[model samples]
Target: MGDLLTFKAGKVRYDETTKRATPLAGKGLVTVAHHEEDATFVSLVWERRGPGAVDSHDGSEETEREELLLFPGDAQWVHCKKCTTGRVFALKFKSSGDRLLFWLQEDNGQAEPGTLSAADNEISAVLNSLLNVLEENDGNDIVMEDKTGENTAALEDTLSTTNTGISIPILSITDALPISSFVAHIRSLPEQALKPYYDLMPETFEHTRENLIKVIQTPQFFSSVDTLSSVFRDSAGIGSLVASQLGYPYQGEGIEGFLNGARESGLRESENDRVAKDQEDVMEE
Candidate 1:
């Protein structure tokens, strides 16, 4: 709720093919703010201008704007690109220290990564504070609500109305098997079968097979699977697969049936219009 944190702008080079960034020259102003209703989310805004362009200069207004929204446990490195100028900038957040890393790439394709330290004490302090808040609530649910009395709805009501379902067939299969049996079956699968999952995860695949099995066997993990399966069922495109595998194919009206129904309704409406016109002609006689 206090003053926003701002830092000087720096030169950034970005590679389209690799989606990486390298830091280049002078510093510019960057601003950071936390969402008023959601403490777990933060917003960062920055601008980059042509070389030697001052705030009061003619070309100063031509500065390119970039904005980013970050949540707890986001990936360490993120990049932003400017479509008009083809300029790319990258930021890497480190929780261990009071610094924000910047990167840009040179014309020759070498990456130059630079660190913005505590010399800008105000910005550094703000960044550190935001990181600390996120670390404190890393795996917890973040509920955003207005503190004022205007929002009186209960959390349950809000969740019920806003939640959408997307199903995961693999997770749903766990419902039919005993927990121990399910865990054993998953652990017995070939490493190749799990590679797709590990690749999708943000962290590197460093855990041993036994350790991974132990991690997934916990009640907390099962609860998360259930919640995710309930929230994302239809949107995940696994509903049909789930129904077919469970021996209960979906019988609801599909797109083709809905189109045929619409066609019949339109035909009836046209017939009624013709009958009304005939009645009007007879009345005129």
Candidate 2:
């Protein structure tokens, strides 16, 4: 939908192993279809589950019919509708729209501008507050935009009560997601579970493994390790509590070894060198 390009609905040839899809132009009308809000309208990867128009890439005029996997394209959002009032579409769905709820509920995944993902569910408190306000004004029909008028002498009824039609890029074939590789990748795997993929797709396996190690070696990961190390090497703050939770059997305070022989190798390094030096000087004095 970027830069106003016309997209003809098309068929695609998909490669399962490599996860690549090559689209063929279908020369059909494309619509945004209005993604529903009350339910997960789409899946991360899906098929329409019926015979669909497929484009025949051959030079001759021809086509095929079959199902194919669908993925969202580069653009994050679009606005279009199936019904036509001289090709009219609503920008924002009505508060009382019939299809606000969706029939299908799938785990919609895409952390983009328009796609609904896990992030939406994270704001329960805000939703609860909105629900309370809506409950208080149950009978009040507050339109987001009001165009009703009894006196239409100055302006015609069409002009007075017309809903302002907004402009948005129409969803088209070019906006579909590319399938050359996996749409998402895993940062971690089950213990030794990647061995099979290691033998099969060595490049992919190594790529994933290397990235996972890289993430672990990051500064954030080191900070987490520092927090974990304190549970055994120090008993300040909640360190002793965490150690006790880990079955360290510590009493009162301190992270000294209990019944378990588990302990950090060599001497416990001083976290605050200045404080340690002060303590040493005081002991000598």
Candidate 3:
């Protein structure tokens, strides 16, 4: 075991073992342990269950109880065998060479940068597409971080407002969709219904309108939107059919609603305003 951290009563405390904190609070504990020199030949088996126990290469079920070493202030991402995906512990060695031991830290497990799940990827795409739509129309509008309930309605209201240089600070849309209503909507759907859209835009549910607006201002943004929309259109079937399958229910093509909303939101109108109409056509098909 490298190290463990526990939380108790809104406060974080450290300990070597559970016993040490038993007299007090065992909310969090970090254990530093390593195998002996003779056990160097032991195989490290990575498992999803429990602390990583040392095992013999001979396929022996017996787990070796390694000695816990003490040193240093704290451990960072020291590189372990199990730092593959998601949030992971950052570990460091207490000493080099024969004195090689390990320390572990509780991390969100994002060791690799730009790492995202399928859901995250799609949300980013939608946000990016919306950004392109916003940027094509020259204005001082900024994306806002809001989602659901009064906030969602507020966004609709703001988009419909007659203001110039409006900024929507949707810094929390993605994180906030887990409220009861949203969860209920998601749960009501068949797993397959959301797959196509999710596959196309893996991170849609995790986006903030603010970040979405920012990305569209990048170079050749319209082209990017066209490309993304084209893919959805060409793929057709479950691909372009995402409006009903994934997003909130609406009449006709939802792209029209988005365009009309964008227009009313006071963002600049595109020279080729037909782009929105074209996207609406894609959605209709």
lDDT of 1 by residue, 119-205 (tens): 433344456566443222121111212212122112111111222686433434234343445446767888877775455432532
Better of 1 and 2 by lDDT: 1
Using lDDT as the measure, the top candidate is 1
Clashes of each: 20, 5, 33
- When 1 and 3 are scored with TM-score, the better candidate is 1
Clash count for candidate 2 is 5
Q: Please give the lDDT score for candidate 2.
A: 0.28
In the range 1-285, model 2's lDDT, one tens digit per residue, is 121111123222323333322333333322232223212121111223335443433344322322111122211111112111111111111121111101112234543322333533322223223222221212111111111111111111111123368653322211121111112233345547555444533232143543343233233433454454455455455545655566543443333332122233112333356679999999999
Q: Which stretches of candidate 3 lie over 4 Å from their true place?
A: 1-4, 7-57, 62-64, 73-83, 86-90, 98-285
Per residue, candidate 3 scores C-alpha lDDT tens digits across 1-285 of: 332222111011112222111111112232222323223211122212234322222233321221222222211221212212221122222121011112122332354522434543333333223222211211112121211101210111112235478764322222222122233454466656555434433253234322232223222333454554455434535332554554433333333433334344334344346678898899999
Estimate candidate 1's alpha-carbon lDDT, on a 0 to 1 scale. Answer: 0.41
Q: Estimate each model's TM-score.
A: 0.31, 0.17, 0.17
Scored against the true structure, residue 13 in model 1 reaches a CA lDDT of 37
- Which wins on lDDT, candidate 1 or candidate 3? 1
Give the Cα lDDT of each candidate: 0.41, 0.28, 0.28
